[model samples]
Target: MFRPGRLQTAPNVWKRALSNFESRITRHETSSDDKKDLILTILSSTATKREARNYLSKYPLLKENDIYQSHRRILDSDVVSQTSKHDKLINDLLLKHSARSEIQLPEPPQKPEIQLSDTLRVALIRIPTPRRLDPETLRGIALTLRKLVQLGVSPVLVLDGKHQIAAGESRLLTVNDFVHQCDTLIQALQTENLQARTVRGLFEQENFSLPELLVVPLLHGIIPIIFPTTVKKDSTEVVMTPFETLKCLVSNLCGFNEAYRRNNANDLLTVEKIIYLEDLGGIPSLERFQSSHVYINLLQEYDDIISELYIGHLDSSVRDVHVQNLTEMNQLLAIQPAATGLITTPAIATLRHGTRTTNPIIYNILTDRPTISSSLPVNLKKTPQLNTTVIRRGTPLTIHLSDDQPDGKGIDLLEFDRQKVIDLNKLTHLINDSFGKTLDLEHYLNRVNGNIAAIIIAGDYEGGAIVTWESAGGRRVPYLDKFAVLRKLQGIPGIADIVFKSLLLTYSDELLWRSRKNNPVNKWYFDRSTSDYCIPNTCWRLFFSGSRVRTLDDLKGYVDVCSKIEPSFV
Candidate 1:
């Protein structure tokens, strides 16, 4: 085998070369990270880079862009640069090692902060076997994984062999051929310090509680790579679809049976994060500023997103993958609402694009939130983070109208009585906590009762929007009386975004809300609203959603009504 880096020698010669190189560098007193980087940087310029790409290139499903792939690929793109750097690094390290080495390695940055919460320590990552293994992308993924293990956030890999079946080659091969090839070649290779045990598939044998085989590897800091292959009744091993494999894991992880409930008797692993790696990247939606949906509140937006994928995009191939991804997420997430579902492409996962310096998966494990906020306007962003989506099950939304009446199948909010559907005590608690002010409950209810248009509540009043109709210029206009989220929940994930989404479902055409000019939440409100203006003589700033606030009369109608509304807070 050709030695990696500047040396094109046999194995024995390569070992000696590494020894001599390390010995020479040891005298320089450089950091371990710097030494490793200088060694890998020089070696990466060798013959093996092409071999790495060629080995995984057989699987056509991987189509990672050259730019987004590991940094090694960047070097490979230009032959002259690779060769020149290789020769120069060898010359400097060997010839100049004694004369105060001229090579200056960049100082290694500090280890990233990994904050593992209750379920953040472990992640069940579903990766389409790392094909098109550009050595650099592999390096980035491996480096990040090692750091996670060091920080106690161990990740288990579920290897999906979809391309083998999707490839036209499956038509010609026998089932035996498929099993042998899929079992052997689909393993995650070429990375340092991470071991992968390919479990032919998840099992439910009468004797085995799914313990012995899987636990040992993990205890030894190995990543257990579960293949999507299962043995059938007749003992013929058949490959399952990626989604089918994940479904079985979810059932066991959620502890469906006594077998699964046991500490180690589970048929599936206890999964905190069910991460899906697809070539299509994140879920898509025409409604978002960017084409990809950054965050999906599955309870409210799942069916609509699924419909969006199916109807508009002519390329059903990509659309079908997106649908399957969300469908799998929605189903698997059914058992564990606390569990998170992340969808992103391999390229996006490995690519450190724009201002992002860390791997997205590693970042997600630490934060439990997407790197980008869902409602952040596209234009305000300094860089584009359009690929990954942070998906979590949302609280079910229920809307109630006043007088228990409907306007032609639509629940009109014109007289929404909070006393009817919403628990008054809980609503009072929510409003008081959100505004940091004590509410005069009697005064608030009396003021909003008859003037209420609709009451929208998200999950036992975790978050809510109170809308009321007001009379101005002899016209009754919808005014956002208060938009209250539990102050504690204000810092939680996607609460405001979900509440606002629910509001639009009920009031599709127009709505108006206001906040004090100095409130920090004004930035959040400004991003979602259609227009805004400061009421000339007052501290309040009125904001409107929908196109109706364009003309002067519309502005007059907004200010005239918003200014007259009475505050129920002390």
Candidate 2:
């Protein structure tokens, strides 16, 4: 009854063996499901779609559409709802399994490395785009780069190809590479650093290379040129031709006829007619010449007669006739002052008793002049008289004169801190050194305080030199050499008036004389004295004498005289 390997020989025995085999196969199939579940679990844990897809690929039974649908169902259904009961169970199972073991993943790969060539190393110098860099940062970079070059080190140059700076870079590379025979090749590198918020600052920082200055044609309008088309021997028939030929004739005439041709010759015929008239005693009653064109035509027809008149062969004798006519019309306002029904003011008497300083005289004249009150609109029978009572007492005066030192020794002292005896040549050098670039001292000296009475050039070891003096009106005159300062104080803005008033505050004196006779420091006489003598003591001490006065007290005697003469002097 019991047969081995037979399906039905021993019914119980066959059943047991078949059961064992079936159990093994069932275990193998279940193991595959476990692997699938593991993968699905991993995929579910993923944060992105790609990871989920990779996880699904491990199980051929898993479809993307199925998983996507499941995901949508999970998102739509609530955990407590009957529709999501299966999903909740599956999710719980996956979470339990995932908590049992930890999964290890690989890290992301790093970016590729850049290997620079030896040629590129020598060629590449770091050139930051100035437009993209802050002004201070660019300046610092330039300084550092220059320092590095000075130290014989070359760095890489970074550039933005899309900019006007490309031209400059090309020029620089050409000069540094081909011309110099040095390998200064630039390598292009893509960078976000080249984008700047403000480019104007870069231009103002003076850190970038500039292109050569060139003048390009800027046409505004067409310019017309006229010339003779053809010349006839008989000189009567007119000829017409192309405008170019006329232009050529004009150019030729301009080059050849230096006496008659002008760059702006709009009325050439009029000028010719005037010349002809000048020769023939001018046009008689020019007002009667109704049409300018007719007059010019008549002048052209009688050209020979006009030439004879120009050569002084005419009966009129143009020069004599003009002279006689001018003499006869001398009574006209053109030749003489108009005699109107108004009283003219005579010159006021000059004040005699005062310190007789030339500056005081000029100052007094400027102050005492009559104010024109009737500069108003309206017809009035009576004119305003000059107010003599308004002539306030003259103020004390101070005159400041700014003069360059004789030689550059002072400037040398400023730089080297050494005391050196300076002669005229050395002083000239000093002045040139100080202001040679923007200004010249000799030209500016006579311009400032043109009424300066005296100048003192004091030597100092620490300060190099100090120029101190009182300006007219006793103001402590500050140094004003720069044209900018002069423009602010003396030009259109009216700042000069305020400054002059401030100067008058300290220098006004009533004793200051208003007459040239009372003022001894007149320019003509002082200049003459200075020119005639160079001895330290022979001429005026403040002027010719080279003696050094240590204090303001030394100038007291001169100041007293000026003060006594002009009460306006301070």
**Candidate that scores best on lDDT:** 1
How far residue 257's Cα lies from its native spot in candidate 2, in Å, is: 31
Clashing pairs in 1: 5-43, 70-136, 70-137, 413-453, 413-454, 414-452, 414-453, 416-452
Q: Evaluate residue 343 in candidate 2 and report its C-alpha lDDT on the 0 to 100 scale.
A: 10
What tens digits encode model 2's per-residue C-alpha lDDT throughout 1-570? 645557555778878778866664554444344345434434333434533443233222332212223433333432221212223423443354465333221121121111111110011111223344444444343333322221112222323222332355543342223212111111111121110111011111111111000000000000111111223344332222222222232233223323323543331111000001011222222212210111111211233323433454324554354333222222121111110001111112111222221111111112211222211111222322221111111122222223333431122222221343324344334334333343344444434323232222222110012222334435433321211112111112112222222222222221111123333323322321111222232222222111123245434433333333221111
Give per-candidate clash totals: 8, 63
TM-score of 2: 0.14
For each candidate, give its TM-score against the true structure. 0.69, 0.14
lDDT (10s digit) by residue, model 1, range 1-570: 544753545667879877855654442332234334423422332223433343123211112211123444322332121122123423433353435323332222222212222121347777765454465665555555554554345477766667766764553363454445334432323244345555543454321224333443443345656655666556555666677767766665455333434643322234667888777788876765436777888887788888777776538688777887888899888877877889887766663222335455655554456766675544333426577887999778776655455433323222233335457678778888888999887777667665677777888888887787776566766677777888656655677777776665456567788888999888778777776899988888998776343567777888987777777788
**What Cα-based lDDT does every candidate model obtain?**
0.60, 0.25
